[model samples]
Target: MVFLKTLAYITLVLPLVVYLILNKRNNNKPSRVIFYYLVYSIVHEILVYYLTNFTDNISDSNAIPLLYAIFTIIEFFFLGYYIYDSLKNKLFKKVLLLCSIIFLITALINLFFIISSGVNNQLIDTIPVSTSAILLIIFSILYLFEEIQAPKIGFIYSNPKFWIIVGIMIYFTGTFFFFLLFSDLSGKDQYNYWIINLICIILKNIFFTISFFLPLENENSNEFDSSFGINHYNTIK
Candidate 1:
């Protein structure tokens, strides 16, 4: 477990460092989504480390898992934004909008479930688990579309779209296992949960790294991106 945990840590951080370095060299900057996720991963790692050591007060550390959920929301925002941008066709655009709506509806449902269950303290944690699962599903369908059409809208998986699918598969699979390991009734050990987190962290980073390297068409093309418009280089310049 210790070895696995260490491996997970390395996988998680290494990709982010590589992305940052590569972006800097290219005179580009990392996205806010990447920045947020990276910071979240680091904090999550530290919390999990303490969690492994702080056995006596495990319940009190519920906030740790909740924090994971919070990051999940951020993750959704990031991926959803990317998906929206990568899509080009009018039909796919509608599908993309529909997916976003489904995710919004699912998120609200999950929120209600959390509140009704009276796990308000664990609200953040629950949100991420459910959201991550839903996001993965949604992304999978999108990848399928890309695969079927074989269109070159400038995604890492543009040529085959299989690479993005693989990344999504790894990411979704990682999140599912992590959720199961940490669910209130999983009966798993702390180390098991950490192992799951480690998997999630690594897989997710891999997804993001692949995404960064994947070619993007009209990266400056999104009108909705006014929220975070302007590349890092533009800002620095």
Candidate 2:
């Protein structure tokens, strides 16, 4: 399973790295948000891997705070970037607006509760992770909007894109549930913590595997189009 997990990482992230590097070289429309996210993932993966060696010490380790901080920042940036992209497209604008409104209301409520109390850092930590997971699902759905305009051009409902969306949704759901369940593991039963961790790891690996083959299939399609026709609208990323 450890080997599988490492393979999953390569599968999921290698394409992303390739995409970013290729786009940068080709002057294609590379997303800076994704770039930063890639960096965050890399750093977080390294830190968390090392920190795992000190399992008994995780609760008080600097790694915990650092990982939380990095993930929170990534979540905020992802939300902002996704919202912008959703609004930029006509088909997704309404959906994006609704999500934005809902998020803002929830955030205000969380803030109100925080201010009322003496500032509960634990609960505050939950907000961004929870909200980000929800927004990522919305973003996955909103991603299909581009397909409405040019069905043949980009990765809308195509095989790879479709599966990738499914993978992302699964990942987001899994991650959010883990956060909600384990945020206060100190008070939970040992079994609960172990179960959540086990389930989360399974889901993470599953999502990673799904994410891995996504790029190659899409790349293949683009290559097919290029060979057959020049005007094959090749902006599927």
Most accurate candidate by lDDT? 1
Candidate 1 lDDT over 1-237, as tens digits, reads 778767777777765676666664323332444555566768776876686576675555455455555456556656566555556666766876776677667765664554455434442354456556666667667656664564233544442224444655666666575565454644445445666656765676666666555543343452334334535436766
Candidate 2's TM-score: 0.54
What are the RMSD figures for all models against the true structure?
Answer: 10.2, 8.2
Q: What range of 10 consecutive residues in model 2 has the weakest lDDT sum?
A: 24-33
Task: Candidate 2: give its CA RMSD in angstroms.
Answer: 8.2
Q: For each candidate, how many residue pairs have backbone atoms clashing (under 3 Å)?
A: 1, 0
Instruction: State how far residue 119 of model 1 sits from its true place (Å).
Output: 6.6
* Best-performing candidate as measured by TM-score: 1
Measured with C-alpha atoms, the lDDT of residue 221 in candidate 1 is 51
Give candidate 2 regions above 4 Å deviation: 20-26, 51-58, 79-83, 90-125, 145-155, 158-167, 184-237
* Candidate 2 lDDT over residue span 56-83, tens digit each: 7554444455455455555555645634
**TM-score, cand. 1:** 0.63
Question: In order, what lDDT does every prediction score?
Answer: 0.57, 0.54
